[model samples]
Target chain A: MIWVAAALLFWGMAWALNAWLARSRHSGLRAVRIAVPVIFGLTILVVWELLVRGLNVPLVILPPPTMIAATFGGNLAILWEDFVQTFLKGALSGYLIGCGAAVALAILIDRSPFLQKGLLPVGNFIAALPIIGTAPILVMWFGFDWQSKAAVVVVMVFFPMLVNTVQGLAASSAMQRDLMATYSASYWQTLLKLRLPAAMPFIFNGLKIASTLALIGAIVAEFFGSPVRGMGFRISTSVGQLALDMVWAEITVAALAGTLFYGTVALVERGVTFWHPSQRK
Target chain B: MNRILPILSVVTAIIAFWYAAVVPMNIHGVLDQAERDGVVVVPGTAKARRDFASLGLVMLNPGQAAKSWMQERPRLPAPHQVAIELWQTTVEKKVTSKRSLVFHAWVTLSATLLGFAIGTGLGVLLAVGIVHNKAMDMSVMPWAIASQTIPILAIAPMVIVVLNSIGIQGLVPKAIISAYLSFFPVVVGMVAGLRSPDAMQLDLLKTYHASRAATFWKLRLPASMPYLFTSLKVGIAASLVGAIVGELPTGAVRGLGARLLTGSYYGQTVQIWSALMMAAICAAVLVGLIGLAQRLILQRMGMTGR
Candidate 1:
């Protein structure tokens, strides 16, 4: 009861502080802007920890955040192995191959208006469909290994990357192309000097989207079938054992890997497309 | 009309490719069956045949390759076989029958629709709160964006299990997942939409002495329609996927996802293919309906450029 009361009091104080900080004249400062959310997140975690302990929620149903953290800390080696199997081997390799193929194909099809018109709508339609259904079939074909997970990730990322790269290739204005023509720049030269640079933003958008899909595809494919190691394998198995703490641990790894992967892509985008309006600031 | 021919040709090319790939993918199994039936195959031993690539095996047993398309559990079911299975399960079986694809689709669809409604409602309310309150905008907005980068779907199984232990079962568990998956996109899109009114527009409202609620109803809400519909399309698709994935962890026996799981377990390639086709059709139809609604609403609002 005391713990619950303390948690409630802390929540009120934290929210009030946030509300005050948000209206403060210094709120525009970068430090204050970052601090507000950080404080809010910490508040939630603290409240969650207190409430679970105070209410005596069962560990199987919901582990406290501190216990989850302890589990995560205790299982570092196992978590690392699963992370390497799922993210580094399965997702990353598939992301490279799939996105590479899509960009190459996009450039090839850029020369033909007929192919573009035909493929764009088809790509869009397929992208919206539940392409994840292919996970089972691919798992069967590739065997219960990282290779199968990679294959699923490949199929998942391919169409979106293709569509984005194709759209990006068309992003440059006729005026820019005409200027290149007036300078007598060859097709390859013009592509390198102008269109590709203009396409970087769109390409990065595709990359960011594909990065998330790759992690998801690799993890979910393992749900269909996988070897003894991998995040999905651990998650499903742990759930069966009612070891909710371990499941939370695996989820923490997935969340970290996903955020880092996406953040890296966005960072690269900012560096590459600094001149683009969205990145100019 | 100008676009029709290219699209048709593209579709034809894909189907043709799928048929051609089926031969190689299933050739080894086909040859094994043929050899068992007393028909001689080149490099006749199964071990010798296993050493060769699938394409080579197909070449060595062209006559046997035709059998691949008709195999009970081909590595890849031929397109027509999938289409036939889809037709049979959907049309031939009664809707109430356990074998019926319609029954499975309905189970999944109901959960999806329920989740989408809950997610969209909560998302809109949150978006409104964020727009109206500086504290929420500052504190919650970044987390909402960051939450999307996390693979929240990975927790579907845990969510299902946790809810089950609490005596919350059936449609609600699946709908909870669907709602969680769909929630972020709506919040993000709605926030952008509600804030879309430019300085000039807001000034106009202010000059008219509009109350905050009146300003929101007339300006912000209407301005958010196009953005709302766009995210709704994305949200609904995500919701459907969530429901399917939620079905997976529970080993639920009644959804399309269960059909896929059981088929995979039993090596019923035909059944898996049909369930996949059904899922694809459901996704297309749901998205199309949302699109239709978007068109109608936007047109009624006089927001469409045309």
Candidate 2:
């Protein structure tokens, strides 16, 4: 009963605060913009904690944030190993290979009108292949190591990166190409100097998208088969053991890793494509 | 003719590559077996000789060398083997049979459609609330976007178990997972669409003294049609993925996900490939249907440029 009251009061106060912030002239300020969502997130967590404790809900069904945080702290070693296996070994390696191959292939395809017509549909078809279907087969081929997980990531990330790079290669206008021709520039030289520069924004878009996909592919691949380590393996095994706290802990690791990976890619993109109109601000 | 020619050439090239790849990928296992039988052979030497010379140089029985490429449970199934399995399962078997790809596809499709419906409804409602109300716009929108950062694969098992504990089972839980995935795109798209009516349009409605609901239906709703259809395409594909993931943890005995799981368990590479092809086809069909509907709706609304 007390928790119910507290939850209601907190909700009401948060609503009032947000309403006030929304109406205020200062709402557009950077601090206020950040504070609004932060406060809202905190309120929801507090309410969730209160409701779970007050109702005596089973921890397996829903662990409070505190329990999740505690489990995360206590299991740092396990978490780190899982991170190394899934993120560094699986996601990062596959991301590099897949993105590298896609970029190279995209450039090759750009040179040939026949390839552009043929490969784009095939690429799209491959992209739509469900990761669930691919992950298990990959595990079989590559065994229970990080190699299989990386294979799945490569398959998952390849087509999206390919499609994006293909589109990006065409970003430069025909006039720019004609100008390059007038300068008597070689095909390779024109690609390096003019077209590649124009393609950076789209290439980075693909990179950022692939960053998330790589994490997802690596983690999900572990669900099929892994050598007793990795976020996905830990997550699935913990669920079977009914260790929901540990499961949530793995979720926390995966979420943080995903966000950091995406953020890093975006930061790099900004650095590389600063001159683009979209990144100008 | 031009489109078909390029596709055909690409497909032929891929088939050639697959056939060539099977020997290297599958021969390792056969060599390991032969070594166990006390055949004193070096690893790379044998593979290199096989690559350059005829199969006779590598093995007494050349047929065994050929057999490596066509093993029933080869590490990498040849393209034709998978194609044959796909044809047999999809065409020879009755749709109601457990072996039929159509049966598994229908199971997955049912959950996907259910979830897509729920997601589309919830997304539209939330988008409407966020667009109309200040608090929801400020609070809910950020959280909605944040929800996507947490991978669905990680959460799927937890969702299944938690729901199972509460006596909810099977299709409902899977549908919820699908809805969780599909809803976000819809929310983002619908929010953009609902707010698409410019100030001038709002002013015109205000000049007519129209009620908020009337103005919404008359001015805003029509403007959002293109965005809604665009998001629906993305949402439906995502919903299918969600359904497949939902099947992963439970190890259910039906659905395309189950086929993959069973195939992996038994080392049936051809079965896995067949399921993968079926899922891809299902996705293509779903997306095509959505595109067709989008065309009809947009044409009727006379907004075809989108």
Candidate 3:
């Protein structure tokens, strides 16, 4: 089938391009590395369009890539609404609350050994609780609006952020703390000048991780219960109606949102943690 | 100041807080669960405890004064109640009662174990291919990551319907979905693990005239064990997720996933929560078991955690 041939061709081109990019010591390898996936993806889409049309495969089993693009273009309104409801209403709120609360709590725990011992394991236990199980309970407790989705996101984002912040709080060398002590820096002053800055890289690691988790938590929570407007809601219901086009469109939206979310966090990370060794060129 | 008391007391206080908070959350669905199921029992004790918590504010101060008191304030069946329910469901039932949580959990466990095996095998194979060939590495890695970006919930129903339409009904469809969801982590982890052996190590092997296969088996594969086990821990959890996700669309006869859905539909919040607890426990136990295996296997290989 032309579809199979196109897929192979596209995949082969991607591989070849990637290998060339990796091996080449040329100045513009960065541009080439980025370009390879783009070119390969476009080629696949073109081949997919050709193959599906050539084979006359049923549109249901495998819609042409062009058709999927058309659907994505046509359904911008619903897609935007789903985006607002999920990303803006649920995920963003939860990520802010969960990550903010974690940093604050990490500071508190850092201040007291007692709090450190008691709280860390509890955070671990909560993190270990599967979202699939907790999502429904949260929906029941918080009601089936964006509130439940936000609650699930909170639970999902909380522990990773906490653990990371805790680790980051410890990131400063003891010698550095000793220098501050010799300088007679106050508790808050020492925290502000040294430890908090030192923790940025670890904090950003948690942020990057939680960005994906927040999106996932919001989406999965919608599956358990929702008010018919979320991306998760649309995807789940559309599939039941066997509307693959709409489903793929919603997926495209989710993919875009997830990528953007992660990218933004990574960008912030690069900015905030520029002094960290990992950021060094 | 630098002692365990702070940690112990803090945790104890939190537990006290959770107990206090949940006491009022009225999970009485637990405490009243026995009576509601028409099992022979004392009903008044649970109701009395609820009443005591609400009306017995006086009793609390007195208990605080006296150190302890009687008529243990009724909880949502307490830990003991849930344990009793677990027993009634798992060990006590003549096996396969509709009321049995174990029956539903078993339905899920079978699919989880099967899917995990298939998924892990597929992941390891793909990892091998990717590690060996530069071409496969670039081509496959991106697709694998992109595949995960599409939420599994969106894909689960399509998998169920498509597989059914193609005359592949029943467990195979669900297992395929699980396998599809699970293999990527293994591939990712294994790739990193296999490459962890350095150029110097590879050069040493080459100097000894080690064949490609010998070097792979002795150096690459063994070096990959830590990464493989870490991925397996993640893969096992992901497979369980796949199994649970698989249940949603297929209209399966049983599984913890099914119980959650049905319980939600029927307003059986307690049942849903109980099933979720069971699933969490299963995941924890399985991940722990993998961790144990990692320890034993790595020790045998003379590799410590470092």
In terms of TM-score, the best-performing candidate is 1
Residue A195 lDDT, candidate 3, scale 0-100: 95
Interface RMSDs of all predictions? 0.7, 1.6, 3.6
Query: Residue A3 deviation, candidate 1, in Å?
Result: 1.7
Give lDDT: candidate 1, residue B10.
85
Worst 10 residues of 1 chain B by lDDT: B297-306
Clash pairs for candidate 1: none
Off by over 4 Å in 3: A1-28, A43-56, B1-15, B27-81, B142-153
- Report fnat, model 2: 0.57
Please report how far candidate 1 places residue B235 from its true position, in Å: 0.5
Candidate 3 lDDT over A1-281, as tens digits, reads 76677767766766567677656675246665566556656767777777777788776677787777899999899999999999899999999998999999899889876677667766665565565567777887798889888898988898889988988899999999999999999999999999999999889988987887788789878888799799888877887777778888888888888877877888888988888788899
Reference-based lDDT, residue A193, model 3: 98
Preferred candidate (lDDT higher): 1 or 3: 1
Q: C-alpha displacement of B2 in model 3, angstroms?
A: 12
lDDT of 1 by residue, A1-281 (tens): 98899899999999999999999999999999999999999999999899999998899998899999999999999999999999999999999999999999999999999999999999989898888888889999999989998999999999999999999999999999999999999999998999989888889999999999999999988899899999999999999899999999999999999999999999999899989999776
Q: On a 0 to 1 TM-score scale, where does candidate 2 land against the true structure?
A: 0.92
- lDDT of each candidate versus the true structure: 0.93, 0.85, 0.75
lDDT of 1 by residue, B1-306 (tens): 789888888899999999999999888888889989999999888999889999888777777877888998898999999999999999999999999999999999999999999999999999999999999999999999998888889999999999999899999999999999889999999999999999999999999999999999999999999999999999999999899889898789999889989989999999998999999999999999999999998899999921
Task: Evaluate candidate 2 by giving its C-alpha RMSD to the native, one decimal.
Answer: 3.3
| Predicted structure 1: clash tally | 0
Model 2, A1-281: lDDT tens digits are: 89878888998999899989977998788887777888899999899988888888898788988999999999999999999999999999999998999999999889898988888878876776575568988888788999998898898889999988998899999999999999999999999999999999989988987887898889888878899999999999999888999999999898899888887888898889889888885
Off by more than 4 A, model 1: none
